[model samples]
Target: MLYYRQHFLHISNEGFIEIPRYIQTYLPHHLRVLIGQLQVSSHQLEIERGLSRGVPREERWCPICHTEVESEEHFVIGCPSYLDLRAEFQIEESLQLCMTMGDQWHLGRFLRATYERRERSLQLTHQTRVSTEQTITEFFQRVELHQRGPSIGLTLHQAAAQRARRRSRMVGYRRPQLYQEDISRINTTYNCMMEQRRTTTP
Candidate 1:
C-alpha cells in the first residue's frame, strides 16, 4: 500500500493527475505487464545460466516531445515546445522552477489546454458539417422550386437566377457564422497562450 501510494504520488507529481481516469488505469495495467514480462525473462535467463540476472531499468521516452532522456519532468512538461507554449501563456513564472515540481504543474496545465483545444476544434468541425448539410438541403429546395416552372425563362436566365438565389442564401449561411465562431475561438486561444507566457516562467 505504501509503495502504491508512493508510486501514485510520483506519477501524479510528474503531472499525471489531470490525465483522464481511463488513461491512468492503463498506466498501472501496462506497468504490471511490463514488470511481469521482465521478471519472467530474467528467470528464463537464470535457468539457462546466462551472465545477466535481470532486465535493467531503462529510461522512459517522453510521449509529448519524444526526447531521448525522457524523465518524468522531461516527458511531461520540460520539453522546449511545451515551455514555449507556457511562455506564450505568461504562466511560466508561476511554474515550479525545479524541473520535477514545475513540470508536474506545467504538464497538467499543458495537457488540459491541449485537450480543450482539440475538443473545441472537433465541435467546430461537427457544426461545420451540419451547416454544410443544411446548405445542401436549402440548395435542393431551391432547385425543386425552380423546376415547378414559375416562368419559361431562357437557359442563361435560369442559370443566372439559380446563381443569384444560391448567393443570397449563402450570404446568410450557417457556414459563415461558424467561420466567425472559429475566428473568435482561434483569437481567444492565442490570447490565452500569450497571457500564460507572460504570467509564467521555466
Candidate 2:
C-alpha cells in the first residue's frame, strides 16, 4: 500500500505540472492544449493504451518514422525525421525546456521551426502546390507603407494625441450636463452657507 501510495504521489506531481508564465503568455490556444497534453501524457499518441473510437489499431505508428510507436516522447525528442529541425532550432532533449528556457524565446522558435519543417515535408510528400505571390506582394506593400509612414494614416505621436483628446472628450461626455449644473449649484449654495455662518459669528 505504501509503495502504491508513493507511486501515485509521483504520478500526481508529474500530472499537476504548471507551464511557465512566459510560455503561456505567447502560446496560442491550440499549442497550449498540445503542451498541456504533453505534460500529462494525454496526447493522442499511439502509445496510449485505449483505442480511439474512429482510429484503427494499425494507425498508431509514427507517421514520420514508422519504426516506433507514436508516443509524445518519441515525437518530440526521439523522432529521426525532425533531426534537421532539432539541429536548426538548437532544441534540447528536455520537454520542460519548451516552457522553462530562461535566456531565449526558444519555445516559440522551436514550434515555428518544427511547424515549417513539417509543412514543407507534407507539401513535398503530397505534391501540394500553393501560390502565395499575391499574399507576399500585399505583405511587402504593407511593410513599405509602414516604413514610409503610419499604416493607419496616423503617426505614433498623432495617434497618442488623438487618443488623449478622445479620452478627455469621453470624460466630459460621461457626465450629463444636468449633473454638472447640479454640482455647480450645490457648490454655490455651500459657499453661501459658509458666508452666512461667518457673518452671523461676527
Candidate 3:
C-alpha cells in the first residue's frame, strides 16, 4: 500500500493508476527503467533499499554528502555531487516545486546523469573491495605455503575436496531412516543376513 501510494503520489478511491506519458511514449527502454525505478522505489538508493539491508538510519546517510538521509528528495536536490548539473538545469531547493514549474525533462536528464554517476561509484567500490579481498587471500596463501609447507597445503586441498563432495551429496541425499519403518529393525535384519558370511569369512 505504501509502495503504491509513493508510486502514484496519491490516488482517489475510484481512480485508476496510469503510467506517465513520457515514460510510456517517448523515453527509451533504459530511460524508462530509470524513471520507473524512482517512481517504484527500485532505484537502489540508500533510503529504502538500505532498510532491507539492515543499515541503520545513521549509516544510511548520503555517501555523497556524509550528512542527511539519502532519500529521493536528497538525491534529486540536496546532494552537492550534482551541483553543476542542478545549476545548469536551473533547479532550486524543491525538486517537486521545480517539476511543478514544468522542468520535468530537466529532472529526467539530471537523474539519468546522476544515476550513471552513482553506478560508477558503486562499481568502483565493488572493484576495490574485490581487489582487497583477493590481495588478502593471496597474502595468506603465500604465508601458508611459506610457513606450513606443501603437506599442510595438500591437506587443505583434500579437506576442500571432501567438503565439496559432502555438499554435492546434500543436494539430493535423504537419510535412509526417513523412508524406513524402523531403523533398529532394518539394522538388525542387515546384521542377521551378514552373520553367516561374517563367520565364514573370519
Best by lDDT, which number? 3
Q: Per-residue CA lDDT of candidate 1, range 1-202, in tens?
A: 3322443323455666443222333234543343233222322212122224332324333333445433333422355545556664434342223222233343444545543553565578799988886665555343555476443333444666888887445454574355888899999999999999989966
Report the poorest 10 consecutive residues by lDDT, candidate 2. Answer: 3-12
Candidate 3, clashing residue pairs? none
Ordering by lDDT: 3, 2, 1
How high is the CA lDDT of each candidate model? 0.44, 0.58, 0.69
Q: Write the per-residue lDDT of candidate 3 for residues 23-49, one digit (tens) a residue.
A: 545555676676567766787789887
Model 1 earns a TM-score of 0.26
Candidate closer to the true structure by lDDT (higher is better), 1 or 3: 3
Global local distance difference test of model 3: 0.69
Best-to-worst ranking by TM-score: 3, 2, 1
Give each model a TM-score: 0.26, 0.39, 0.57
**How many residue pairs clash (N, CA or C atoms closer than 3 angstroms) in each of the candidate models, in the order given?**
20, 0, 0
Model 3: residues with Cα > 4 Å off, grouped in runs: 1-33, 56-58, 143-202
* Model 2 pairs whose backbones collide: none
